[model samples]
Target chain A: MQKVMMGNHALSWGAKLSRAEVIAAYPITPQTEVVELLSNMCADGSLKAEFIKVESEHSAMAASMGAAAAGARTFTATSSQGLALMHEVLHWATGARLPIVMGNINRAMAPPWTIWTEQTDSIAQRDTGWIQIYTSSIQEIMDSVIQAYKVAEQVYLPVMVVLDSFVLSHTNENCDIPDQDKVDAYLPRFENAYRLNTDKPAAFGGLTGPDWYYELRYKIEKDTERSLDLFEETGKEFGEMFGREYGLVETYKLDDADTVLVASASIASTARPAIDQLREEGHKVGLVRIRVFRPFPSELLRKLLAGRKKVLVIDRNISFGMSGAFYAETKAALYNEKKAPPMWGYIAGLGGRDVPLNVIRDMIEQTIAEEHPEGDIVWIGVKR
Target chain B: MLEIRFHGRGGQGTVVASKVLAFAVAREGRFVQTFPEYGVERRGAPVVAFTRIDDQKIYIRSKIYEPDHLLVLDPTLIGAIDVTEGLKPGGWIIINSDKPAKDFPQFAGFKVATVDATSIAVKHRLGSAAAPIVNSAIMGAFAKITGFVGIEAVREAVHELSPVKKDENVEAAQEAYDTAEVPKEQS
Candidate 1:
C-alpha cells in the first residue's frame, strides 16, 4: 500500500492486478526483479497464470506473442541487450496487432558492457510499432502498466512501459498503488474480435502482393493514426474512474511560459525540480513528459507546444549520426503546428552517467538566459 | 541553499544518503534534488553524490565542485579527492572520524565538525566498527551544523528506506548530532 517500492516492483503489482494470464521473461538486471516477483506470485498460486520461463528475451517475446495470439493476456520485460534481442518479435507482436504489454527498464547498451543506466536501449527502437510509454516516477511506472493494458487492448497494439534502469528502478519511492478492484473495473479482458486458433483460425500476416501491399500498409497506418484518439478516450475514462488521467503527452505549467522542457523517463523527474527552481527564481519554464512514443501523438503535442517558444528537449539516448531520438520525434510532432517552438536538443545522461538536478537547472538557465543559434546538441553532466 | 557532497564506496549508501537528505529538506516545505555521479568503480571505490536544497528552488546544473557543506563518509577520501576544494567560506564540514575536529587541516579556515559515526553505529549494533553506513549519522551532524533540515525529518525519511532499524539510525544520528560541535567559527 504505502510501502517504499522500487519502480520495477510497482510494475509487477500492476501486471498481476490487471489479470495478466501469461508472463514470459528471462532475468536481467533491474528488470529481473519485476519478472521474479511475477514468477513468485505464480508459484504461490496468488496469480492464476502460466509463467513461461523462456530461453532468451527473443523467445520471451515470441512466447508472449503466442500467448496473446491465443487470446490470453500476456506480458513480459527486458533491458538493454535483452531488449535488443527481442527486436525481431517486437515488430511481429505489433504487426499482428497483439496487445502484449512489456516493461522495458531503460539500460545502456554495452560495448565495454556497462550496466548502470541510460536510455539508448529503448530509444534505438523508435521505429518499432509498439506504443512506448516512458515513466518519470514509480507511481507513473505502476500507473502506466495499468493504462498500457487498457490502451493496448482498445487498439490492439502492444505497449512498452519504460523507466530508467536504476534511477526509478532501484531507487525506491512512495507510490500510491491503485486497488485491485479499481484496476479490474478500469481494465477488462482481452476480447479481441480476432484470435488465432483452429476453431476460427484465419490468416494473420498473410503474404501480400504489390497490388495489395500498399493497401495493407495503409490500413496499418490508418489504424495506428486512429489509436491516438482511442488512447485519449480510454485515458478520460480512466480519469473518471481512478482520478488519475494520463495522455500521450503531459504538459506541466507550460501555460504562458516561453520555455518548456520536453523529456521522458527519468529526465522528467530531474527536470521537474529544475523547473520548480527556475520558476521560483521567476523564470517561466515548464515540462512535457511523453507517455506515448509510438503513434507519436503528433496532434496532442502540436496543441501543447504550439505557441511556446524556445522549447528544450532532454534525451538520455542518441541516434548517433542523426538527431536526438526524442527531440527528433518532438520536431516531427510539432512540424505541422501553426506556431512551432524552436527546440534545442540537450543530450544529458548517457551510458548511465549521472544527470543531477543542477544540470537540468543549468539547461533551463541556458535556454532562457541566452540564445544559441548554432549548436544542435548541448551535452550536459560531462567533465569539461 | 545547502549543497553537500558525499564520498564513499559504491554500495556505502552515499547516493541514498543524499536522497534521504533531500526528502528531509522537502519535509520542511522546500524543493530539493539528490543524485549520484557514480563511476565504474565498484564496491569500495570512491563514489561521489550531490545534494541541492534551497529556500526557493535549485537549478544550478553542475557536479558541486564548490560545496557549501562537504561530508566525508570515509576519512581516507580526504587524500584521494579534493574534498575541500569547493567548500563555501564560513561553511561547514562534517567528517566521520575518531580524530578531533580541529585536527583536520583541510577544514582549517572553516567551521569543521567531526563525529565518530562509525563507532556510534557500532555501539548501536548497526554495523561493523570498520565501516558503518554513516550517511544518516553524518546527516545528523549536518542537521546540527547547517540547520538545513531537522533530525526528526531525517528519521522520518530513514523509515522510507529502512523501517526496522529506523529508530536505531535515528538514535545513532542523534548521538552524532550531540557530539557534533562547531569549533567557534574560524576568525
Candidate 2:
C-alpha cells in the first residue's frame, strides 16, 4: 500500500518486511524513531520478532552478533555517537563474517552536540569491512534495507544501509510498501552453513595467530570483491519484482553531457533539480549518485566518468587534512585511466546545513569556469 | 506541485501536522512529501515544517524557499519570526488565531484566514491551555478554506494518527472547519 511515511518508519517497515528475527538497537537522535516503531511492532505481535532495548550501541551490535551467530536474522539501527560507540563491535561483526544488517542514520559527530544530518559518521567507518549503501529517498531506504540483507548474506559480510539523518529520516514521502508475500519471495529466510547451531558446535571469532590471520583478512577482501557482482544481480531481481531499479551509481541527463556532478544520499536527490535547471538553460550537465559506497563500484565509476570534460563531487563529509573521502576514492579509482575527467571536490551541507539550489548551481558554474582548480578540496558556502 | 510551509513552536505538533496533511493527500492518489526544519528543539522555540503535493513524484529535497501556502499554528509567531518570509504573492495563509482576519497583521498581500484553534482545543480539552495541541484544528481550517483536501480527509487522518484523543481531535477539527473565517477583502 502507498503511504506518506517518515523515513525512520520506512526503515521499520523494511525490517518488518525482511522478517528480521532479532532487532537489537539503542536509540539516538534522528535514529530513535526507527527502532521505537520497531519496538511497537514487536509488542503488537505484528512483526513476530524479539526487540532488544540495549543500553548502548555497543551492546546493540554485540547482541546482534550473538543473535546472528545463533542462526537468527538480526538487525540494528543507530547514528553519530552511537555508531562511534559501535565501532569496535562493527569490526567484530565483519571479522566474524556475520551477515547483520544495520541502519546508520548519518549524523555529525559532536563536540557542539548536533543531531543533524552529516555523512562523516558513516564515512569514517569505510574500513570496517561492511558493505555500505546510501539512499536518497524513503522508498530507497526501504528497498535498500531489503536488498542489503540479500547482498550481505550472499557474501557473508555485514551491510550498513545509510541515509542522511533528517534529510531522509525525518522527512515524509510517498512510498509503496511491497506485499509481504512478494517480500518473502524476494528475500527468503537466512539459512547459512556458518550459523551457530547446537547440532554442530564450532568456535567463532576466536583468536588467530599470524599464520591464519592474514589469510582470513585476504578472504574477507576476496568476498567483498565478489559482493559487487552479487549486488548487481540482487538489484536486478529487486527491479523485476518492484519495478524500481538501483545500481551502485545512477546517472541523470548524462547522455551527451560534458560536465557531471557526483553526490550521494539526500544531497544527490537535491542535485537532480539543479541538473534539470542547468539542462533547460542548455548546459550539458549531468549527475551521478553513488548509492553503494563499499565494494566501491570503482570499475563502473571509472567507465562512466572517464570521458567527461569535468566532474564535480559534492561530499557532505571530510577526511580531515586530505580531501572528501568520496573525492579521494573517485580520483584514485580513475588515476590509471587513459582519459579521466578533471574532478573537483566541494564539501557542503555538513551538520544539516541546507544545500540550496543556488549553491548547487554555483558549484557547477565554478567547475565549468575554472581551467585548473586551485585546491584539492574547496569549502562551499563557508562564511569565510 | 503545491509547496506549503507550516509555522508553529516546538512541541506544538508542527511536524505531525505536516505529515497528517501529506498522508491525507497521498491517500487521494497524489504524491506528497513532508518534513520539518528545526535546531536543538526546545519547547516554545519557533519551528517550521514543509510539505509538497504533486501529481507526479518530487525530486527536490531542499527546504521550501517559496511556499505556495502557509499554515501558521501560532498567532504570536507573527512578527517574532518571518512566518511569511517566502510566501508567494496571492498565496493563502491559514492562521490559528481568535482575532478577526483583518485585525491580524497584513501578510505581504497574501490571502488570510483565521481559526480559533486554541479555543477549540480548550473547548475539547485536548491539551492544557499552556500547550494546546492545535495542529488538527489548524489543519481543519486549512482543508475547509483551501478545499484542496476534503474535511473528511483531515478527520480520517486525526482518527488514525491520534492515539488517545482521537475523538476529541476529530471534533476539534470539525469545529474549526465550521468556524474559521476568511477576511472579506481577501475573499
Candidate 3:
C-alpha cells in the first residue's frame, strides 16, 4: 500500500504502530495534524490508546514521563516555542531515564511571528541527555519513530525525533508503512531495568551525596557508552523484522569521495541529488546524513571521513555568537585522527529559507577549490 | 505530463486537492506526486499545492513555480500571490469566482476558465461562500479539464480521505469537470 503521506501523518502512524500506550500532545503548527490523526485513531478505537489532551507542551512531557514511569510505552509531540516551553522538563525526562519518545517539528522562534521551519528549536535543546535523531524523509520519520521506542527503552534515554517545520513535517511522500503485526514482532514490550511499582517501590530520581555523585555521573556516561552498541543491535534487529535499517551515521556515496557534506533532516534529500549532480559533473562529492545526533557517533564519523579529502558541514541552526553547533562537534569527532581532511562549516537555511542545491553545489565546489580552506566557517548562500 | 497547481487558503482543502488528484491520476496508471508549500499551515494563509502527472517519476522538487494548469479556489489569492506565476504560456486557469473569465484577463495566461464553484458549493450544501471548500469540486474540475482521471477514481480518492459529504462533493467535482474549459497549449 503506497500512499503519499506528510511527515506528520508518518509520525502518527509510527506512534500508532509502535502500540504507544499513552500519547499527550498540544496542537501546534505542522505538529497539529500528527496529534489530530493520533487522537482520531484513539477516538475511533483503532489504536486502543489513551490520548491525553494536555494543556501545554509542559504537561505533554509530564504526562509522557508519568506513563513511561508506569512502565508503558509513551509518546508526545511539540514544536518551536512549545518545545522551548518544555525545555526544563526535557532535561528532567532524560535525566530520570524515562525512555519517553517525542517528535519535535522544527520551527523558527518568534520576534515577528514566523512559523517557518528551522533547526534552532531542537539544536537549542541539544545539551539534554535525550538521544536526538533527525529525519530527512517521511519514510525515515516513520521508521525512526519505531526505532526510537526500541532504542530509548534499551538505553533508558528519552528520544526526540526531529523533522523540519512545514517542510518535512507537512510535505507528502510515498512512504511504505510496515504492518502492525510485523511491527509488534520487532518492538515487543517495554521492560525497564528501573521502573515504578509497589513491588519495586524504589526512588527513581533521588538526592545523591557529593561523595558518590561523581562516580554516579561517570556511571551514567559509561552506561550511555555501553548503550551505543545496544542501540545499534536494536536497530539491526528491528531491520531484520521490519526490513528497514537505521544507524547513527548513514553514509551516502561517501566511498572514494574527495569531499562530503554532513547534514541531517529533510536537507539530506536535497543534498543527495545535489551530490549526484556534482558527481556527474566529474566532482568527487558525497553526503553523510547523521541519523543519531546524540552520543555524537564520533568514532564512526572519524572512521568514515578518514580517507575523504575535505568535509563540509551544513548546519541549519547556529550557536548564536559562536560557530555552527555541529561544526564544533564534527571537528572534535575527526580531531587527532590520521591525516584528517580540513573540515569547514557552512551555515544555511537558518530561518527556513530553502537550502537550495545550487548553494550546496557552490559550497562543495568552493571547498574543493580552496588551497587552504582557512576560515573557521564559510557562510554559504548569503546575499550580503 | 499534466501538472496542476491549486491556489487557496490553508483550510480550503487545497493540499487535499493535490493529493486526491494524485490518487485519481495514480488510478489511471500514471506516476504522480502531490505536495503543498506553505509557511504556517494555518487556517487562512495563502497556500500552493501542486500535482505532477506523467509516465515518469517526478524529480523536480522546486515549487511548480510554473504550472501547466491552475486551479484557484480563492480568487483573492489571484492578486496576493501570482496565480499565474509559472503557468505555461496560454495555460488554462480554472477559478472559483463570481466574475466572468473575461474580467480577469490580466491574471490569466492567454486562456481563462471561470466557475462559480462557491455558488456550486453553496447549492450543493457544502458550506457558506466565506469558507467554500471547493477542493473536491476543484479536483473534480481538474479531472474533467484534462480527462486524466475519471469520476469513479476521484470518488474513490475522496472516500479514502473521508466518507462524509461524499455524494455532494462527488457532484460538485463532476460539475467542475464538465464546465472546466481547456485552453490551447504552448509550443
Candidate 4:
C-alpha cells in the first residue's frame, strides 16, 4: 500500500518488514524517529523483535554485534556523532563476519556542532569493511534496508544503508510499502552458519597470531569484493518481486552526453533536474548517481566515464587536505584508463548547505566552460 | 508541480500541517513531498515547511524558493516576516485569521482567503483557548480556496493523523471549510 511517511519511518517499516530478530539502537535527532517507531512496533506486538535499548551508539553496535553473533537478524541505526562513536565496533562487526544491517543517517560531524545532513560521517568509515549503500529517496531507503540484509547475510559482512540527514530522513514522501508476505518471499529468514552456538562450543573473535591474522583480513577483503556481484543478483531478484530495481550506479541521459555530473545521495537526486535543464538548453549533460560507495563500483564508473568529453564530480564530503572522497576515488578508479576524460572535483553542500538546481547548473557550466580545471578542489558557493 | 510554503511558529504544528496536506495529496494518487527547514528547533521560533505536489516523482531535494502558494498559520507572522516572500503573484494566501480576507491589504495582489482557525479550534476544544492548534483548520481553508485537495481527503487525512482530538480536528476542518472567506471567483 502507498503511504506518505518520513524517511525515518520508512527505515522503521523496512526493519519491521524484514522481521529483524533484534533491534539495538540509541535515539538521535533525525534518527530518533526510526527507533521510536520500531519501539512502538515492538511494544504494540506488530513486530515481534527483541528491542534492546542501549546506553549509547557504541553500546548499540555492541548489542547488535552480540545479537548477530548469536545467529539473529539484528538491525541498528545512528547518525553523525552516534555513528562516529560506533567506529571501533563497526570494525569488529565486519571482522567477526556478522551480517548486521545498520541504517546510518549521514549527518556532518560536529565541533562547531550541527545536526544537519552531510556525507562526511559515513564517508569516514569507508575503510571499516562495511558495505555502504547510499540512498536518495524514501522508497530507496525502504527497499535498500531489506536488500542490505539479504546481501549482507549472503556475504557474511555488515551493510550500512546510508541516507542524508534531513534531506531524506525528515522529508515525507510517497512510497509503496511492499506487502509483508511478498517481502518474506523475497528475503527468507537469515541463517548464519557461523553463529555462536552453546552446544558447538566454538571460540569467537579470539586473538589470532600473525600467522592467521593476515589471512583472516584477506578473506574479508575477498568476500567484500564478492558482494558486488551478490548485491547485483539480489537487486535483480528483488526487482523481479518488487517493481523498482536498483543498481550500484544509476545513470541519467549519459548514452550520448559529452558532459556528465557525478554525485551520491541526495545531491544526486537534486542534480537530475539540472541535467534535464542543461539538456533542454542544448548542453549535452547527464548525471551518474553512485548508489554504492563501499564496493566503489569502480569498474562500472570507469566504463561509463571513459570517453566522455568532460566529467564533473560534486562531493558533499571533503577529505580535509586532499579532495572530495568521491573525487579522489573516481580519479583513482580512472587513473590507468588511456582515454579518461578531463575530470573536475567540486565540493558543495557540506554541513547541510542547500545545493539547489541552480548551484548544480553553475558547477556543470563552469566545468564545461573551462578548458581544464584550474584547481584540484573547486569549492562551490563558499564565502572567501 | 505545485509548491507550497508554510509559515508558522514552532509548537503550532506547522510541519505537521505540511505533512497532513501532503498526505491528502498522496491519497488522491499524486506524488507529494513535505519537509521542514530545521533550525535550532525551539518553541515559538519561526518555522518554515514546504510541500511539493506533482504528477511525477519529485527529484529536487532543495528548499522551495519560489512557492506557488503560501499557507500562513500565524497571522502575527505577517509583519515579523515576509509571509509572501517567494509566493507566486496570483497564487492563494490562506491565513488563519478572524478578520475577513480584505482586511489584509498587504496581500492585495494575490488571492486571499481567511478562516478563524483559532476560534474554530477553540470551539472544537482542539487545544487550549490561549494557544489553539490551527493547522487542520487552515488546511481546510486551503482546500476550500485552491481546490488542490478535496474536503473529503482533508477530513480523512486529519482523521488518520490527529493524535488525540481526531473527531474535533475533523470537525474543525469541516467548520473552517464551510465558513472560510475566499475570493468569489475561487469560492
Candidate 5:
C-alpha cells in the first residue's frame, strides 16, 4: 500500500513487515516516533512482536542482543546522544555475531544541545564492526531496513540503516510499501545452528584467552570484509522483488563526467537536482551518492571515480583537527592509484543549517575554477 | 513542480496540514514531499513547514525557499516573521484573516486571497475560539483558490487525520471552500 508518512514511520513499517520477533528501543528525538509507533503496533497485535521499551539506549541494545542470541529477529532505533550511549554495546552485538538491525537517525553531537541533523554520530561508529548504509528518502529507509536484515544475517554482522535526523526522519513522503508475503520471501525467518537453547544449554560470551581471542577477532574482520559483495547481492535481490534498484554507490550522470560530487544521507538527494541543473547548463558535473559506508565499498568507488579530472566531497560532519570524515575516507580509498583525481572537501549544513541550491552550485563552480583549491576544508554557508 | 510554505504557530497543526496536502497530492498519483523546519521546541512559537508537489519524482531534500504559494494559518504571525520573504513573483498568499483584502498588507508583485477560517472553525466548533485549529479550513481555502488539489481529497485527508470532530472539520472545510475570496485586482 502507498501512504504518505514520515521516514520514522517507514522504519517502523519495515520492522513490522519483516516480522521482527523482538524490538527493543528507547525514545529519543527524531527517533522516538519510530519506536512509539512500533510499540503501538505491538500493543494492538497488528504485529506479533515483543516490544521492549527499555530505560536507556544501552539497555535497548543489550535487550536486542539478548533476543537475537536467543534465536529471535531483533530491531532497534536511536539517534545522537542515545546512539552515543549505545556505543559500548554496539561492539558487543557485532562480537556476538548477532544479526541485529538498527535505524540510526544521524544528529550532530551536543555541547550547545541540538536535535538537528548531522552525520558525525553514526560515522563515529566506523570501527564497531557493523555495516552502515545511509539513505536519502523515506522509501529508501524502509527498503534499506529490510535489506539490512538480509545482508546482516548472511554475514553475521549487525547492520545500521542510517538517515539524517529530522531531514529524513521527520519528512513525509509517499512510499510504496511492499507486501508482507513478498517481504517474507525476500527475507525468511532466522534459522541458524548457533543459538542458545534451554533444552541443550550452552555458554556464550565467555572470557577468551589471548591465544584464542586473536583468531576470533580475525574471523570477524574477515566476515566484515566479505559483506561488501553480500550487500550488493542483497540489493540486487531486493530490486528484483520490489522494482526499486539499490547499490553500494549510486551514481547520477557519472559515466563520462569530468567532475563528480560525493555526498550521503539527505544531502545526496539535494545534490541530484544541482547536478541536473548543471547538466542542463552544459556542465560536465555528476553526483555519487554513497549508500553503503562501512565495508566502505572502496573497490566500487575506485571503479566509478577513476578517470575523473576532479572530485568534490561534501560532508555534513567534521572530524575536527582533520578534514571531513568522508573526504578523508575517499582520499584513502584512492591512495594506491597512480594518478588519482584531486578530491576537494567541503563541509556544509551542520546542526540543521539550511543548504540552498546556490551553495551546491557554488561548490561545483569553485571546484571547476581552481586547479588546486584554497584550503583542504572549504566551509560552505558559513558566516566567516 | 509547485512549492508551498505554511506559516503558523506550534501546536496549531501547521506540520500536520502540510502532511495532509502532501498525502492528498500523492494520492492523486503525483509525487510530493512535506517537512517542517526544526527549531526550538516550544508551544506558541512561530513555526514554518513546507510541501512540494511534482509530476516527477522529487530529489531535492532542501527546504522550499522560492515558494509558489504561501498559506498563513495565523494572521498574527504576519509581522512576527517574514512570511512573504522569498515568495516568487506573481505567487499567491492565502491569509486566514476575516478582514477585507484591502485592509491586509499589500504586496506589489503578488496575488492575495483571504478566508475567514477562524470564523468557519468557531462556527463548526472545531476548537476553542482562543486557539482555533484552522488547518483544515485553511486547506479548504487553499484548494478553492489554487485548485492545485481537489476539495474531495482535502476532506478525505482531514477525516483521516482528525481523530475527533470529523463532521466539524468537514463542515469547516466546506464553508471555507465556499467563502474564500480572491483579491479584487487578481479577480
Candidate 6:
C-alpha cells in the first residue's frame, strides 16, 4: 500500500518488514523517530521482535552485535554523535562476521553542535569494513533496508544504510510499502551455522596472533569485496519481485554528455533537476549518483566518467585538510585510466545549509568555464 | 509540479498541516513531498513548511522557493515575516483569518481567500480556545479555494493522521470547506 511517511518511519517499516529479530537503538534527533516507531510496532504486536532498549549508542551497537552473534537478524540506528559512539563496536561487528544491518542518519559531527545532515559522519567509517549504501529518497531507504539484510547475510558483513538527516530522514513522501508476504518471499529467515550455541561449545573472538589474525583480516576484506556482486544479484532479484530496482550507481543523461556531476545522498536527488535544466539550456551535463559508497563501485564510475570533458563532484561533507571524500575517492578510482577526465571537488551544504538547484548550477557552470581545477577544493556558497 | 509554502507559529501544526495535505494529495494517486524548515522548532516561533505535488515522482530534495501557492495558518505572520516572499504572482494565498480576503490589500495581484479556522477549530473543540489547532480548517479552506485536493480526501487524511480528536478535526475541515470565503472575482 502507498503511504505518506517520513524517512525515519520508512526505516522502521523496513525493519519490521525484514522481521528484525532484535532491535537495539538509542534516541537521537532525526534518528529517534526510527526507534520510536519500531518500539510502537513491537508494543502493538504488529511486529514480533525483541526490542532492546539501550542506554547509549555504544550499548546499542554492542547489544545489536550480541543479538546478531546469537544468529538473530539484528537492526539498530543512530546519527552523528550517536554513530560516533558506535565506532569501536562497528569494527567488532565486521570483524566478528556478524551481518547486522544498521541505519545511520548522516548528521554532521558536532563541536559547534549540530543535528543537521552531513556525510562526513558515515564517510569517516569507510575503513570500518561495513558495507555503506547511501540512499536518496524515502522509498529507497525502505527498500535498501530489506536489501541490506539480504546482502549482509549473504556476505556475513554488516551493512550501514546511510541517509541524509533532515533531507530524507524528516521529510515525508509517498512510498509504496511492499507487502509482508512478498517481502517474506524475497528475504527468508536468517540462519547461521556459526551462531553461538550452548550445545556446541566454542570460544569466539578470544585472541589471535599475527599468524591467524592476518588471514582473518584478509577473509573479511575478501568477503566485503564479494558483497558488491551479491548486492547487485539481490537487487536484481528484488526488482523482479518488487517494482523498484536499485544499482550501485544511478546515472542520469550520461550517455552522450561531456560534463558529469557526481553526488550522493539527497544531493544527488536534487542534481537531477539541475541536470535537466542544464540540458534544456544546451549544456551537455549529466549526473552519476553513487548509491553504494562501499565497495566504492570504482569500476562503474571509472567506466562512466572516462573520456568526459570534466567531472564535478559535490560533497556535503568535508574531509578536513583533503577534499570531499567522494571527490578524493572518485579521483583515486580514475587515476590510472588514460582517458580520465579532469575532476573538480566541491564542498557544499554542510550542517543543513540548503543545496538549491542554483548552487548546483553554479558548480557546473564554474567547472565548465574553468580550463582546470584552480584549487583542491572549491567551497560553494561559503562566506569568506 | 505545484509547490506550496506553509507559514505558521511553532505551537501550531504547521508541519503536520503540510504532511496531512501531502497525504491527501498522494491518496488521490499523485506524487507528493512535504517537509518543514530544517531547524530547532520551538513553540510560538515562526515556522515554515513546504509541500510539492506532482504527477510524477519528485526528485528535487531542496526546500521550495517561488512556491506556486501559499498557505498561511496564522494571519499574524503576514507582516512579521515575508509570507509571500517567493510566492508566485496570481497564485492563491489562503489565510486563516476571520476577515474577508479584501482585508489583506498587500496581496492584490494574488488570488486571496480566508477562513476563520481558529473559530472553527474552537467550535469543534479541536484544541483549547486560547490556542486552537487550525491546520485542519485551513486545509479545508485550501481544498475549497484551490481545488487542488478534494474535501473528502482532506477529511480522510485528517481522520488517518490526527492522533486525538479525529472526528472533531474532520468536522472542523468540513465546516471550513463549507464556509471558506473565496473572493468571487479571484475564484
Model 3, which residues run further than 4 Å from truth?
A28-31, B1-4, B9-12, B26-33, B39-45, B52-69, B74-81, B87-119, B129-131, B147-150, B162-164, B179-187
After TM-score superposition, the amount by which residue A165's alpha carbon in candidate 4 deviates from its true location, in angstroms, is: 0.7
> Model 1 Cα displacement at A43 (Å)?
5.2
C-alpha displacement of A266 in model 5, angstroms?
Answer: 1.0
Model 5 segments beyond 4 Å from truth? A28-30, B182-187
What CAPRI class is candidate 6?
Answer: high
TM-score of 1: 0.80
Give fnat (model 3): 0.14
DockQ of model 5 vs. true complex: 0.84
lDDT of 1 by residue, B72-91 (tens): 88888888877778688877
The candidate with the higher lDDT, 2 or 5, is 2
Predicted complex 3: CAPRI docking category: acceptable
Estimate, for each residue in A153-231, the C-alpha lDDT of model 5 and write its tens digit.
8888899999888889999988998999999999998895688998889899899999899999999989988888887
Residue A88, candidate 4: Cα error in Å is 0.7
Native-vs-model 1 lDDT? 0.78
Q: What's the DockQ for every one of the candidates?
A: 0.16, 0.83, 0.32, 0.93, 0.84, 0.89
The regions of model 1 sitting more than 4 angstroms off are A29-32, A36-49, A192-216, A241-243, A258-261, A272-287, A306-312, A333-346, A353-384, B1-5, B10-36, B49-71, B84-92, B108-111, B123-187
Task: Give per-residue lDDT, candidate 3, residue B129.
Answer: 66
Instruction: Report every candidate's CA lDDT.
Output: 0.78, 0.89, 0.80, 0.91, 0.88, 0.91
Q: What is the lDDT of residue A280 in candidate 2?
A: 94
Report the poorest 10 consecutive residues by lDDT, candidate 6 chain A.
A25-34
- Ranked by TM-score, top first: 6, 4, 5, 2, 3, 1
Lowest lDDT sum, 10 consecutive residues, model 2 chain A, at: A25-34
Model 3 residue B42 distance off true place after TM-score fit, in angstroms: 7.8
TM-score against native, each model: 0.80, 0.97, 0.89, 0.98, 0.98, 0.99
Q: Pick the candidate with the highest DockQ.
A: 4
Model 2 residue runs over 4 Å out of place are A28-31, B182-187
lDDT string, candidate 3, B130-150, tens digits? 776778777776666666689
Residue-wise lDDT of candidate 2 within B1-187, one digit each (tens)?
Answer: 9999999998788888997798788878899998889576899999899999999988889999999999999989998988888789989988888887778666648888888888888888877887888988998889888988988888888888876789999999898888776456563
Score candidate 3 by TM-score against the native.
0.89
On a 0 to 1 DockQ scale, where is model 3? 0.32
